[model samples]
Target: MALLITDECINCDVCEPACPNEAISEGDDIYVIDPDLCTECVGHFDEPQCVVICPVDCIPHDPNHVETESDLMSKYKRITGK
Candidate 1:
């Protein structure tokens, strides 16, 4: 599943660079995760890099965009064209 950044985010600007898929970006008020591009780092890392580096621990699974591990891998492949 894609991750969601809640209002608790402090905008530390760490998560944006940590996202391997480049899915995180600055929104009007906080960082937002693009579900279409988010792969939870399945193809690049053992865990989500953004989640690991976020200081506020505000990143959480996006309930509206729930997806299985296989789905994420497919997304990763599509993104990398591999």
Candidate 2:
């Protein structure tokens, strides 16, 4: 599944650099996770890097974009050649 940033974000800019997929980006006032790029760190890390580095716990799974591990793995492979 993709990760979405909630309004509770503290805007500390911590999660931005943590995303291995380069999915997270700074929005107008908070950070936003691009669904197209967010793979929940499936192919890169055992855990989601943004969720770990977020200070306010603003990151949450995007139910609208439910995806299986295999789907994410496919996406990761397509994006990074891994």
Q: Which candidate number would show the highest lDDT if scored against the true structure? A: 1
- Superposition TM-score, candidate 1 onto the true structure: 0.98
Off by over 4 Å in 2: none
Candidate 1 per-residue C-alpha lDDT over 1-82 given as tens digits, one digit per residue, 9 for 90 to 100: 9999999999999999998889999999999999999999999999999999999899999999999999999999999998
**Poorest lDDT segment (10 consecutive residues) of candidate 2:** 51-60
Model 1: per-residue Cα lDDT at residue 62: 94
Q: After superposition, how far is residue 51 of candidate 2 from its true place, in Å?
A: 0.5
54 Cα displacement, candidate 2 (Å): 1.2
For model 2, give the RMSD to the true fold.
0.8
- lDDT tens readout by residue for model 2, 5-78: 99998888888889999999989988899998999999889999999887777788999999999999999998
- TM-score of each model, paired residue for residue: 0.98, 0.95
